[model samples]
Target: MIESGFAKNLTGQNLSSHLGPVSGKGDVRVGFFWTKVQLRTKNPALNGKIVNRLCIAKQPIGDRYTVSHAYISQQDAARLYPQEFGIFTQYETAPANGTPLSDIPGVSRSEIGLLELHAITCVEDLLSLHPDQVSQIGMAASRVYKVAKGWQDKKDENEEILTAADVQAKAEEAIKAMEERLARLEANNTRLQAENDVLRHSASGHPAQSAAVTTAVQAAAAPGDDAPYEFPDDDGFMAGGDVVTGNDDLSDMPDPMKD
Candidate 1:
């Protein structure tokens, strides 16, 4: 199985180089926030290489915890110390903001992991992610691509908050413009509908006129009693006090007003 390792100094180191020597038990106190070294063996092939690196440490405190080379596996610590109070490498550290990527000694930028990059909590973490991976998590590809290219979010440095009166004025102007356009379209539609009704009334009278003309031409072309022209009743054709009659031999016909 894959295993993880971490190393911490049980005893605190001397701070003499930075400050003068203390008399008795020393002023520096061992604390939880002291530096820690960690190593991981995700696969078996890297186990021996990791173990050998941890066995050579002469001292386990001070600048030792600060260097990346001080991290080692449990197997090598057993071989080197073989006694009490040697390097006690464990499997994990308590959850906290990890060491910053910039402050991790001897580790290069390329060797950084997702967790390590997250510790930085900066644009560097965003840029390290692949574009496809970002897209898979439903983030915008262009935004991620811009981040990878070292782009920062746009900030309106000179922007000032608008007053309430300014916001109200802009809203009123927009509503007024929309209402005016709606009123103009309504007027145009009414005018077109009136014009269309007049045209339709005028067109209805032509069908009866065309039928009468056709009957007259037929009567003139025929000479014998064998030809008979049937005319429909004209009582249904009255409009605006005008009575329109169908075609007949009007030379001998009486006016309907006299009848």
Candidate 2:
């Protein structure tokens, strides 16, 4: 039974009376909380002393309001244990996130109630129950355990498949990025090589051309001793009177006759 009257924490505020009784028979949210309880002593020195106490807070199903008398005393908790087995389980073993017993496949209401009587409130609790404890639940304990185990196994397998797919996608993205980078690098290298070739051609072309021109000018200005000199006419013929042979002893040669 829940306490009726003002809660110990809030002065002159009747929380339990405002809200109806709280029980774990129905769906409710249960969580731990700290309550500030005011102490009243006969001695004047001990009067008005406030202390913090750890307790439970119960809210309606679907995350509704916090019901009255959310914080139940030890005596109230013990009395309500048979009705609110969840509270007793939370008080003793703090279970982690898990599927509710009612949600387990092939589990009936009577089986759930029986399991709760033994402080097994969730799927995790049932799966981890000792063989001895499971035997205590009756002949159908093994069947119920197998069903919960199957559900967990299937969930884990799905998670693994999703993880593998995610990993593969990331790897593909990384490979694509690396390939693009390599292509850019190759293009830059090719451009640099072309520029180098152009630079080499520009640097060597002028010097070679200038060298050929100098050689031709030197050959024309400084002829060999045996070289001949001649004057050409517009008809592509050498002028006969202007020809000078390399032999200096030409005094005996006959003079040209005027036409």
Highest-scoring model, TM-score = 2
How high a TM-score does candidate 2 get? Answer: 0.28
RMSD of each: 31.5, 27.5
Clashes of each: 0, 0
Structural similarity to truth (TM-score) of each candidate = 0.20, 0.28
How do the residues 94-189 of candidate 2 rate in per-residue lDDT, one tens digit apiece?
Answer: 432456776677789888777767778678888887767797678777677778889888978799788787677666666776788899999999
Please report how far candidate 1 places residue 188 from its true position, in Å: 0.6
For model 1, the run of ten residues with the poorest summed lDDT? 25-34
User: What are the Cα lDDT values of the candidates?
Assistant: 0.47, 0.67
Q: Per-residue CA lDDT of candidate 1, range 143-212, in tens?
A: 4345334422231222233345455655666677678889999999999999999988886769888778
